[model samples]
Every structure is written in C-alpha cells, then in structure tokens.
Target: MTLKEATLVTGGSSGIGRAICTMLLEAGRTVVNLDYVLPQWSHPNLVNFQADLTDAAQTRERAQEIVSQYAITALVNNAGATRPGTIDTATIDDLDYVVALHLQASLILIQACLPALRACGNGRIVNMSSRAALGKPERVVYSATKAGLVGMTRTLAMELGGDGITVNAIGPGPIATELFRKSNPDGAPRTQKIIDSIIVKRLGTPEDVARATLFFLSPENSFITGQVLYVCGGVTLGTATL
Candidate 1:
C-alpha cells in the first residue's frame, strides 16, 4: 500500500531509532532509514540509506537524495552517541565526537531537509533527547548536548511555526535496549536497581519512547511545539511515586 506521507529517521538501524522506524512502518508510512548500519527489519515500503551523518557533506547529499526521491513529511533526529565521564577524565576527542554526533550532525541534516519539509506543507520534527539532561552529573557531556538539542527544538519551533511545521523533543530515561545493556555491563542487577527507583518498577522499553515520539509526530499534533514531552514513566515527576 502506498502511504500519503513519508518519514525519515536518522540512526534508524538500531535501538531507539529502529523502534521509531518500526512504529512508523506499522502506521503504514513510507519510511526511510538513513544510517551507516542496516536494520534487521525489512519492508517493501522502507528505504534505507547508508551514510555517516557526522559528515556534513554526506548528510547534505543524503538529505537531498531522500527528499528528491521520497515524499518526506516528517523527520526524527534520533542519531546520537553517549559516553560516561567527569570533567577531568573526558578527553578533548570525546567532547568533539559527542558534540559532532549529537549536535552538529543533527543540525546539518535538519538544515539540508528544511526545504523539503517546508514544501511538504505539514512537516513535523522530533528531536530525540535524554531524561539525563534533567539532573545527571556523571553524563555531563551527554546531558549538555541533549540540553542543546532541546534548545534547538524550541528555536526551530519558533522559526518553523509560520511555515506549518512543529518541532518537539522526547527525553527518555533508562530504556531497555542492546545499547543500554551494553552501556551497563551488569545489566540485570543495575537495571533492577533503576527499576526499583521508578514507580513503574521496570526498565523502559524502546517502544515506550517510540510511542511518545509517534504522538508528537502525528498529523493530529499541530498545536504542540517547542515542548519537551518526556517518556520516563513518571521519572520526570521527581521524587514522586515513581
């Protein structure tokens, strides 16, 4: 079946990015997966583009390729990297890589896609951030970059609202995925402790953040923009029940 709209998701080959792509595919949208790695899922309606998003020229070229070839009405900037560190131990290379991947690449892609999005008439942008931005010291670089993402979301909203575009962000906390497990080696024990701290009592799934993201990306969400809708399962509510 042909879809009325097409959505492009960066880093769509794995983890949260994969889940977002899957959700869009399930909703019957023509989806494009732009990443260096190919995801395990296959569908006739899905198009995969392999590229390093951190390379500005490559991102620009790929963006044009996607827009010229597909009807892209939505973009989900879900590509990013994370590293654990404190001010002292984090190297210059670490900061540069993190910022380039998490911030610069996202901006480059968005800039490249803006024209297509504006032409689509009802474009939507979803920037993937992290709940760690709220109050996490261990992840100073990651959190700061995510906080910058939120800033970009708001600014884009302001600039794009006049052109029928809505920009919003999603901050997910402690999601259960291969990357999460990889980040925390003692996955079960560490995850259990995290769950204990939450009201939900379970580590968040990729689907959780995907669902929250879909809502903002929905054609029905015209009224919302520049807002950080968190899918932390009450984690954002503070020392509340969760």
Candidate 2:
C-alpha cells in the first residue's frame, strides 16, 4: 500500500505559516507543524508538534521523528522572527537569538529531513525568505539571515536535484501579517509609503504568499528550482502602479 505523503512546516501557528498549513491541508496533503505556539485552528489532516525550532537539539529530534512517522514530501521553513535595530542599537544577543531561530534552526531541520526527502522522490522544500533579505532599514540581522536562506536554497537545489528534491524560496514584501503590523501599523505614514511603493498599491496577504508556495510545490513546477519568487504585489519592480 502507498503511504500518505505529508508536508512539514515550522512556525505554523500564525500568519504566513498558518496560511501555508491551511493551504497545504486544503490541497489534500497531510501537514505536520513544528511550533512552540499552539494554533487557533485545527484539522484532522493537520498534526501539531509543539517544539521550539530555535532549540537545535529538539528541532532535530522532532524533524527526524516526523519523517520516520510520515512520508514528508515537502518542508517549508517558515519559522523566523525579527529583531529590529539600527547599527548602533543591534546587539550581539539579537544576532545570536535570530541566528538560532532563523539560520541554524533551518539547517538542523534540513539535515534531519534530507534522508527521508531523498527517499520520497520528487520532494519539495520552500524557504520563507523576505524582501527584507535584499535590504531593510533597522533590520540588518534579519536581512542577513533571510539572505542566507536564499543562498542556502540555491546551493541545496543544485546538490539535491539529482535526488529529485527541488529547493526554492519565497520572498514576500510588506505582507500584512501580525508580524508586519507589529512594526508597520495601519494608517501610519510609513505604512502608506510602503503601500505606494507596491505596484499593486496594496499590502500582500498571507494567502498570496501561500499561493506562491503552492506553485513552487506543484508537480508541474518540476523544472523550477534554486529560484526565489517574490510575492510582493510587484513591489520589487520599484514603482507603484498608482
């Protein structure tokens, strides 16, 4: 009998991660979420593992266990938090913690899942990078880590291509998730400027990013890898539509 294939997602308790989990589950794929936070919703097809991904040892343990219990065909590294600070204010501690949660945790998860992903055939891996990766003010560390994820995505795509595992990244811009709003409040001038810069003249939604992720995971998208898809209302174009 064929075993059911599943997608493993980190930080799936809220915002973009939650949206990805919802979309994957709706696609008839089983989903396992690794997050220390409990989500507000649930489905029979969705399984939650309350593991803090920042903890490397625990991350490896849970990732291995999940792969052993399920055919993990896809992995979405969507767990990241920002520590906003200018050059003067950014502390070494900020760098350390974000690195643990962002870069190191992803590395650990990927390493743990490599064997199962190789065995699964046609496996997919999506890293949730941000336009901040290109460069964002007061977000030096966040930018660096997200940029690193992009670099890792490129390298892994080539290294794992022969294994039929595709790796890519989604770089979202000014998404209106809880995380985004924490810094860019609605009706604020800064927020307005961000909207105006978007060619779509609007902030991106979690669903928009989720759809891009699904596109990358699609069987028809087999030829696409080592690439970053920017789901940012065309903000990357550098001019607003209005």
Candidate 3:
C-alpha cells in the first residue's frame, strides 16, 4: 500500500510503544515499527523494521534506510529499559547501556530522519521519558537518561521549530504493562504502596499514554512543543492521602 507520510516508532513491538502504533494505525497513518522483535499484531499500514537501538551505528543505518524508502513525518523515541540501581551501586556499564539506548540512539535516529522530517515541513517528535526523571530511588541511571530526553526535546523543539516541527515528551507513571509487572512485581508491598499513592487509585494503561502521545503528534497541536506531558494518573502531583 502507498502512504504519503509515515511515523517511525522505536520499541513499537510492546507496551506503550505497541499501543502508540495501534492508535496511529487506527487513525489511518502509516507506521514503521523499529524494534528488536516484530509486533504481536499486524496491519496493512504497519511495517516492522528490526534494529538493535542500543547500538547507535545500527540505529543510524536502519533509520537512514527507512527514511530513504518512506516519507517519514513523525518519530517516536519510545524504546527504553529500566536498570534499577542507586548511585552507590550503579556501575559505569549500566549507565552506558541506558544512555546508549535512551539518549545516543535517539540523537542518531533524529539526525538520520532530519531530511525526511524537514521535507514534511510539519514533522513531529515525541520522546518517552518517565516520572523517574523527576526523582526516584534505585533508578539513577534510568532517571538520568530519561531526564536527558527532556532537555533534548526542548532543544530540538527550539532548533526545529523553524521547520514546522514540534518536539515533546511523555512521562508515564506506574503503567500496567508486562514491563511494569516485571519491574514492580504484583502483590509486593512496594507495588501496593505505589498503587495507593496514585490519586486515581489505579495504575495507568498503555492506551492512556498512547492517547497523550497522539495528542502531541496531532496536526492540530502545532502550537504545543518542548513540553512534557505526564500520563501518570496524577502521580506527579504527589501521593494522595484519600
């Protein structure tokens, strides 16, 4: 099938990334998923491109190849991993890996996609950050990398605004996904504490984040840029006692 403009989403095989891909497809947009594995579902508008995002060289090469073949108008840097460790325990290797996946790869992909995005003249970029970036224990490296995305998003928004491109970020909190379950195992006291802390009294879903992401990527949101939207069920407002 032929498509005029396509959105490239990293880590689109699972979790929030998968939800974003599904939403974009439902909206009739061409989607190219860049992930280590193919998505569980398929659509005529969706194409899966496998790439190891932690490897900047591979990400750059693959991004170039994809943009060369498709008219890419949007990019979602949603690929991430949680390496839990405190400053006292975190190792250099841990920081490097997280930075590679979350920061370096995003820079490479953005550079590679610049031409195609510029051609669209109304390109959009949404970076996936996290509430951890604001401050969270046992997540020094992960938080650092995610926070870096916020700065990157803002800088890119300013730099690319002249081209009609908007750059923003989404910070999701306590989402009920396979990754969240793995990281915050069910029935754990810590998990219950987290659940009780949410003002909504519930964990968020991938669709919750997908909806926020789509809002930033929407053409009508041309005026919103360099902003971070937290889809955390009001968790960012601090723990509620109710």
Measured by TM-score, the strongest candidate is 3
Residue 115 lDDT in candidate 2? 75
2 versus 3: better lDDT goes to: 3
Q: Return the number of clashes found in candidate 1.
A: 1
Best by lDDT: 3
Give lDDT for model 2. 0.88
Q: What tens-digit string does per-residue lDDT give for candidate 3 at 1-242?
A: 54367999999999999999999999999999999887778899898999898887888889888977888899999999988999999999999999999999999989888887887788999999998889899999999999999999999999999999999999999999997888689899988998999889999999999999999999888999999999998988853122
Ranking of all predicted structures according to lDDT, beginning with the best and ending with the worst: 3, 2, 1
**lDDT values, one for every candidate:** 0.84, 0.88, 0.91
lDDT tens digits, residues 153-209, model 2? Answer: 999999999999999999998899998898899999999998998888999999999
TM-scores for every candidate against the unseen true structure: 0.92, 0.94, 0.94
Sort by TM-score, top down from the best: 3, 2, 1
Of 1 and 3, which scores higher on lDDT?
Answer: 3
Each prediction's total of clashing residue pairs, residues at least 3 apart in sequence or on different chains, is 1, 0, 0
Clashing residue pairs for model 3: none
For model 2, the stretches where C-alpha displacement exceeds 4 angstroms are 1-3, 238-242
| Model 2: worst 10 consecutive residues (lDDT sum) | 233-242
